[model samples]
Target: MDSPEITEAMDALRRRLVPGTRTILGIAGTPGSGKSTFATWIQQQFGPGTAVVVPMDGFHLGNAVIEGTPLRRRKGAIDTFDAGGYLSLLRRLVRRDEPVVYAPEFRRTLDEPVAASIAVPADIPLVITEGNYLLADQEPWKEVRAQLDEVWFVDTPQELRLHRLVARHVSFGMDPAAAVAWAAGPDEANALLIQATRPAADRIIPWEQELE
Candidate 1:
């Protein structure tokens, strides 16, 4: 869908592209709002050689680290991520110094981050990073905003978002009832926190309407 909102975001990122420098575009939204999908679409629009997506989910604290702790229950919460490490990676991406930078990828089936799974080459002019907390007003998270050329918040309907979250959980091995519980519980809580940061985004895309 080449909607105006999508086109505008594309143009904004295109403007940031320079001969020797890289531009980082951040797509933030509540869980299940399709930020990752949107980021992928943007990458395809720009072509793989020109744009690559480096997700924040790759920084999630491993299940082993959260096991036997309260974090295990709130696995997708803000504190469940390696904020410092993500910030460090963003800094490196902004500097554009390396020939190739490897990034971690989150595996939903394993529920852990696989190290060095994504490779961001120096020639790629645009890097699109999507996640739930890119606009979060916290220590290292706020620093994440500084490294991005532009941050767009994807706004999806709450009902649609919750439905997507439940379906995602079920697809990933949770029972139907358990998926519903999770969507209404931890995921909803995270969604609320993410939504609160909407005012800070450079652009707020009505995802359901625009992307449909």
Candidate 2:
């Protein structure tokens, strides 16, 4: 689907959600693949009433915790996140008995993920958790897939994703060279791992493709 069409399809998804389902719609993609924009669009179409988004990025372990790890520099790596905490949040969010569930949101400007930035209220249905490793086969991550009612894998051409990632890194204050290096290096590696999990998703998607 083209951009216009995709937006309509997502809005349609939001309309179909009945209040208080505790349902999760997982959207997974490599960095710079536009998953966030797509997700934000879906939320906007819901018009501030239903279907609030609670991103998994909100569960990133603090820099303090990651600073001690071997994978410290590659903060975006799957291992750097608070996988267990994320699991717990998903469990709570998926519970049918809950009147409301609070979740976090990642703040890019501060480089800190805020806790409890969003709430999945009893009346609003459909929680969207978009991230890199929701369907990963690795430990901790594997369990997340089970909470999702459906998983949508967002695909983009490698070159396009790479270009966008590098630009974003630079915009975020990384030097041009450093941005390109990380995007082509660790970022690409993570992308490869994410690619392997595509088949596990309920739906495989390319941005702008129609949802059928």
* Model 1 error, position 7 (Å): 1.9
Give a tens-digit lDDT track for model 1, residues 1-212. Answer: 56698788778777777777788999999999989888888888765589989999999998889999999999899999999999999999988889999999999998899999999998889899999999998898889999998899998888888878888898889999999999899998998899999999999887763331
Model 1: pairs clashing at backbone N, Cα or C within 3 Å: none
Q: What's the TM-score of each model vs. the native?
A: 0.96, 0.88
Which parts of model 2 have CA positions greater than 4 angstroms off?
A: 1-16, 208-212
TM-score, candidate 1, is 0.96
Query: Which portions of model 1 show Cα errors greater than 4 Å?
Result: 209-212
Instruction: Report the Cα lDDT for residue 34, model 1.
Output: 88
lDDT of each: 0.89, 0.78
In terms of lDDT, the poorest run of 10 residues in model 1 is 203-212
